[model samples]
Target: PLQVKRGIIDKQTGKIAGEEEYYVDRDECNRADTTLAGLLKLPPVFDTTSGQGSVTAGNSSQLSDGASATLLMSRERAEALGVRPKLVFRGYAVAGCEPDEMGIGPVFAVPKLLQRHGLRVEDIDLWELNEAFASQVVYCRDRLGLDPEKLNVNGGSISIGHPFGMTGSRLVGTLANEMLRRKARLGVVTMCIGGGQGMAGLFEACL
Candidate 1:
């Protein structure tokens, strides 16, 4: 559900404090051949007649040029340095699936992680499922019965662009920030790998 505010209201008075304005601009990358154009122009490469392709540039992750990094430290070291942690790493899990249906990797990985940690889907506050492709994202979200509001509120890789190796880190950063904004307690970051594997991590937001 998209939240729309037409005017600003006073927190104390509970009245319209001022007029508000908003704009909806066209995405700069909206084009027929661009990956950010989404699944419209792309074919199901894996299900193509030629057997060479259905995965189109529009429907797949864009080849982006960028970098990201995440630093980890022991609680003692972090506290000693007066560095306030944003999230605590709980645990992680990996699972495998058929190479042809590699997108289903998260379907297996997430359950293994929850079972290992003795948690359930409703226990999580946020979910960062990497949008490697529209097909995969749609499949995983439906299969997991994820809440639309709790999933990728700021848009996914398809809209922001995926920087391959850095995507995992990006997901973590985004999830952490969103968790903080929502005052959420727990979040999950997960992604599917190329070789029929999926990786997932559990996080507890600080405050």
Candidate 2:
């Protein structure tokens, strides 16, 4: 559900934070066509439609000319620079998987990360699992027993175009902002990499 600051909602953003419902206003959307009819007229990325197969243009992440960056430094360095940090990187883990099943990478990586920190799935306050695909996100949620309520409260890569190399920066930046807004203690940024691997990074609120 959208946590609307105003009681009224319509022509605002969306009712549910998902891939399809997200709106691309004015200059944000660089797609050839933004209309529903134009989108429907386009062919699926795969041989089958969404009803037949999980892969579709709607659920897939597209590469765009997008960029995001974050300043990273040790606690001492931050202190020396007089820069108070907003979060601390607790742990990160990467796990291998079949190339074809790469989307399931988080299922393995998340456990390793949490286990290393003596934490559990339930202990996580928020998650920014990249929406590489709906199928993968759904699988990771069920396999890892993640709470949907605590998952991607906002739409993900599917809604926001996925810019390849900047995904880490983008996800982490978004995670940090949301964590601060919600006052969440633990937040995770995770995604499945191409060539059969999944990566997850755990973070804790510092300030």
Q: TM-score for each prediction?
A: 0.76, 0.77
Q: Which candidate is the best by TM-score?
A: 2
Task: Write candidate 2's Cα lDDT for 80-152 as tens digits.
Answer: 9999888898889999999988888999899999999999899999998885677788889999999999988
Number of clashes in model 2?
0
lDDT of 1 at 150: 85
User: What lDDT does model 2 reach?
Assistant: 0.81
Can you tell me which runs of candidate 2 are displaced by over 4 Å?
1-44, 47-51
Q: What TM-score does prediction 2 earn?
A: 0.77
In Å, residue 24's CA in model 2 sits off its true spot by 10
Model 1 is weakest, by summed lDDT over 10 consecutive residues, at 22-31
